[model samples]
Target: MFDYQIKDNCLSNKNILITGAGDGIGRQAALTYAKLGATVILLGKTVKKLEAVYDEIMALGAPEPAIIPLDLKGATKQNYVDMAATIAEQVGQLDGALLNASMLGELNPFTQIHEQIWQDVMQVNVTSQFLLAQALIPTMLNAKNASLVFTSSGVGNKGRAFWGAYSISKFATEGMMQVIADEYDSSTLRCNAINPGATETKMRASAYPAEDKSKLASPEDIMPLYVYLMSDDSIGETGKTLKAQ
Candidate 1:
C-alpha cells in the first residue's frame, strides 16, 4: 500500500534527518526516503521502534539508517547542538531535515488551557523545532542544497474551540517556516511546512477516537509530496505551505 511514483534512488547520495521517526508519518517518511536511496537518520524517543524502522530499511537494501534517541519535550538546546555535531562528524553534509516531531497536548476550550500544558506543548511542538533547525542548518548549508519540512495541522491555520495548544503550536510552526525561508532565500537552503490533512496515525486516532480510522488515508499515501519536497526536484521552491491529500 506504500507507494509513490517519484522513482527509486532519486535521493541517492543524500542524507536526510527525520524527527519523531519511531512511528506515525515520520516513520513512513523515513522508510520512503530509505527506499528512495537516501541515508535516513531516524530520531525519536523510542529506540526499539527506531530499530524496527532501521531493520525495515536495511531489509530493502537501502542505506543503513542511523538512529538518535531524543525526547523532544525535555531535550535542551545543547542536546540539539550535540546531535548536529554528531551528524556532521558522520554524514559530512545534510540534504534534508524533517521536523515532524510534535505533541498534541490536550483538546480543550481556550479558557481551559492550562499554562503548564501550554508550555509543554509549545516546547515540543515549537521551541524544539527552532532549536533543532538552528543546530542543523550548518550541515544543510554545507551541502549544495537542502530542504527543511515542518509538519503542520489543519487547526494551525484556523483556530478550533477545543484544539487548544496543538493549534497554537502549529501557527508558530508556520511563522517559523516563513522566517527561516526568508533568511535563506538567496542561499541553497529552503524551509517549508506541510499540512497532511487527516491521516491514519496515532495522533489522528488520539484526536478523533470516535472516527473510523479505516476511512482516512494512511501516512504512506502522502509519500509523493514528502519525496518531492526533499528531492532536488523541488529546488527553488521554498516557504510555501503544502497540503498533502
Candidate 2:
C-alpha cells in the first residue's frame, strides 16, 4: 500500500466529491473520507447505494453527506455543467473530486474489439471525465486548494494485447490529467492520477474471475494514497501517476 499515515480530521471543513461511490474503491473512499471529517458528495448510478453510503457516513457521526445519482455513460457536458453549478450552490466550494467511475468494456484482441463497447468505455472513462473536470474547475477554484484525481490502470500507459478500449481510455485519462495539471501549474488546483494496482474489487473479479481473492489487497488497504491526494499533504504534487498496492 502507499506509505502515508492516516490522520484524524485531515479533511475537516472540506467538501469532497466521489463518483462510483456505491461500490469498490469508490465506496471505501467515501466511507474513509467521511470518517476523516470531509463532507462527501456521493455520486453513482444507483440511488439506493448512494443512500446507503450516505447513511453510513451519517452513522460515523461525520458531517452530513450529499448524494448525486448519475450514470456517466449517458451523461453530457451540460449535465456536468449543471451538476457543478448545483455543487457550487450547495457546498459553496469543492475541495476535491475523485473521478473514479469507469467502464471496463471487454478484454479482447484488438482485431476483435466491438465498436459499441469501445465507445462505451471511452464515453465513461474519457469523455465524461473531460466534461466533468471542465465544469468543476471554476467551483474547485473557489477553495484555497483543490485536488482533481483521476483513476488510471496498469495498462494505461502500456499497450496490453487484450486490454482493448479500456487501456486506450486510460491512456486518454492520463493525458487529460497532465493537460489539466499543466494548465493549473501555478494555480491552487492540482491534478493527478492513481493506479490502484490489482486490488480486490468487482472490476478485478470480472477481469480475472479465477484469481485468488484472498491474496489481493482490499480497497481499504489502498486508501492512504487516496486520502493523501485529497488532503493538504499533497499540495504541490500534480500530473503524476502513483500506484497503490
Candidate 2 TM-score to native:
0.99
Clashing pairs in 2: none
TM-score of each: 0.97, 0.99
Q: Give the distance in Å from residue 147's predicted Cα in candidate 1 to where it truly belongs.
A: 0.3
lDDT scores in order: 0.92, 0.95
Candidate 1 ranges with C-alpha deviation above 4 Å: 1-4
Give the range where candidate 2 is weakest over 10 consecutive residues by summed lDDT: 51-60
Against the correct fold, how does model 1 do in TM-score? 0.97
- Model 1 lDDT tens row, 1-245: 22336976899999999999999999999999999899999999999999999999999999899999999999999999999999999989999999998999888889999999999999999999999999999999999989999999888889988998999899999999999999999999999899988999998899899998889989889889899899988899899888887
Steric clashes per prediction: 0, 0
Off by over 4 Å in 2: none
